[model samples]
Target chain A: MSETNELKVREKQEVAPSAELTKPGPVFTPHVDIFETDNSLTLLVDMPGVKADDLNVDLRDDILTLTGDAKPSLATPGEKIYGEYETGRYYRQFSLSEVIAQDKIDAKLSDGVLRLTLPKVEKATPRRIMVQVD
Target chain B: MIYRTLFGAPGRRFGASLKELEEMQQRMDRLFNGFRDRSAGRVGVGAGVFPAINISEDTGAYYVSAELPGVTSADLEINVTANQLTLAGERKISKEAADARYHRREREAGRFSRALALPGDIDADNVKAGLADGVLTITIPKAEKAKPRQITVQ
Candidate 1:
C-alpha cells in the first residue's frame, strides 16, 4: 500500500471481435489463481501453447509482470475444415505487497500452469517474546 | 417457455437477486416491446456459464481449442466420431491445506462438456490433441475429397 494508488491487477480485453481491439491480433489475459500461505503467496497462471522460452516474468519496483508470446498452433499445412480458438499472446501483472521477500521469488511452469511463489520476509512472520519476571 | 421454466414456478424458485430479475425484465421488455434493433445485428448469446470457444476452418483440416484453466491433462477426455466431436472435463479444487481460507475466489471448479457436429468427411485417425497453458488444442485432418485440389488446363 502506497500513497500513489494502483490497482493490484488489471485485465485488458484485447480480443473483442467487433474490432474494438487495437492490437494487430488477439492477446488474451491469462487467468491466475493467487493463494496466500503463512509464508508465501502462490500464483498459478494458465498460458497454453506458451513454451518456456517464450515466457517472460519480470519484477520491477514491486510490480510483477508476466508476458508470453505463443506461436499459432492452429496454423497447420492441412486445409481448414472447422475452427475455434485463435493463437495470440498473453499478459498479466500484479502488484507485489511489501511483506514479501522480493529477492526469493520462485517460479515454475508445467502442464500449462505457471507457478510463482513469493515468500514472506522475516519481519512479516509472527514472533514470540518471552515474559521477563523481576 | 424459457421464462416459464426460469420464473414460471415462482414459489419454487426463491431468493433470486433483484438485479438478475431486473436484467430478465429488461430482456422481457425487449421481447415484448416490438421494437427491433436492426442496426446491431448480432447472434443470440448462449447461457452465460462455462468456457467460451471459437472455431475456424481451412482447406485441409479443422482446429478446435477450449479454455480450461486449472484443468490437467488427466482430467480431460475427448471423443471423435465420423461426424461429431465431444470434450468432457472436470477442474478439481486443491485440498492440501486444512486451515486455508479464501478472501476471494473467482475461479470455479466443475465438470464441463461441449460437443460439436463435425463434417462427415473427417479423418479420425490423424486427429491430434495438445494441452498447454490451460488451453486444449485439437487438430483433425479432413477426408481426401475435402482437401483442396487444383485442375490444370491442357
Candidate 2:
C-alpha cells in the first residue's frame, strides 16, 4: 500500500542464465529489488549500461526471462592506462506462480533501472468477508 | 604528455585505512584466483566483492566508471586533487519491510572509497560526474599540457 506507483516492491527469486553455449563476454546477473502489494508484484533491477532499445524481457510458460546488452564505454581514444571492472551483458530470469496475472505484466526502464509490474489475479487478493446476523 | 605517472611508484596511495587495505588485498586475490563462477555470475566470497572501476583517457578527458548497482548520486561523493581522484559512497539496506527474508543473500551494504591516481593533471574546473542507473561516470578534463598536440616540421 505504501508504493505510490502501484508497484509494491517485495521478495522474489532469480537466477542467472545457464545456457551451455560459450558467451562471448561476461554475463552479469543484475541486482534486483522485488516488492509485492495486495494486487501486484514489482521488480526493480539495476542494469546501468543497458539502454531501452537493447533490453529484452520475455515471459514464456510461467518463466520470465530478462536479457540485455550494455554497450561498453570502455573504448577510449587514449592508450589503456588501467582497468578494474568487467563489462558485458546483463541477464536474469524468474518463475511466476499460478496466482499471477501474467498477461498484464508491465516493464519500464529509466536511469539504468528496470521496473517490472506483475499484477495478481482477483482470487489471489484478499477480501473482507461480511458477517451474517444470527 | 606525461607517461611516467602511469607507472609511478605508489609514493603513497591516498593513505588507506587498515580496513580498506584488507579489502584491497582480497580484491587482488579474487582477480588472481579467477573466481568467476559461471553459475552465480559472482565470486562466492560474500564480503570480498570490491566495486571495480575502469579508468581510461582520451585527448580531452579522463573517464572513470564504477560498478555500483544500488548506489545513487545523492549517496556518493567525488573528489579531485591535482593527480588523484577519490570516490566515496555508501550503499544502504532497504528497510521498507521488516518481515522480509532473503533466500540467497549476496549483495551487501556499506561504505566504500576508491582512490585512484590520475595519469595526468586535471583541469579541475571542467570535471563532470554523472550517475546513470547504478554506474557512476566521472569525466575529468586533462590539463592544458596533457592534451595531445601535433606539431608541424617545416
The candidate maximizing lDDT is 2
Worst 10 residues of 1 chain A by lDDT: A1-10
lDDT of 2 at A33: 74
Categorize the docking of model 1: incorrect
Off by over 4 Å in 1: A1-12, A15-23, A73-87, A124-134, B1-51, B148-154
Query: Which regions in candidate 2 have their CA more than 4 angstroms from the true location?
Result: A1-23, A35-38, A73-77, A124-134, B1-50, B97-106, B149-151
lDDT by residue (A1-134, candidate 1, tens digit) is 22222112123244444335565666777766777877777777777667788899888888888988776653444443333344578887778775677789898877666778888787635778999999
- Candidate 2 lDDT by residue in tens digits, B20-138: 88999999987766644434344332223255666677788988776676677887888888989887777654564554333333445677776778878889878898887567778
DockQ of each: 0.18, 0.23
lDDT of 1 by residue, B36-105 (tens): 4222221222323344454556777787666665678898898988868887777775654655444435
Report the number of the highest-DockQ candidate. 2
Error of 2 at A119 (Å): 2.3
TM-score for the A-chain in each candidate structure: 0.70, 0.71
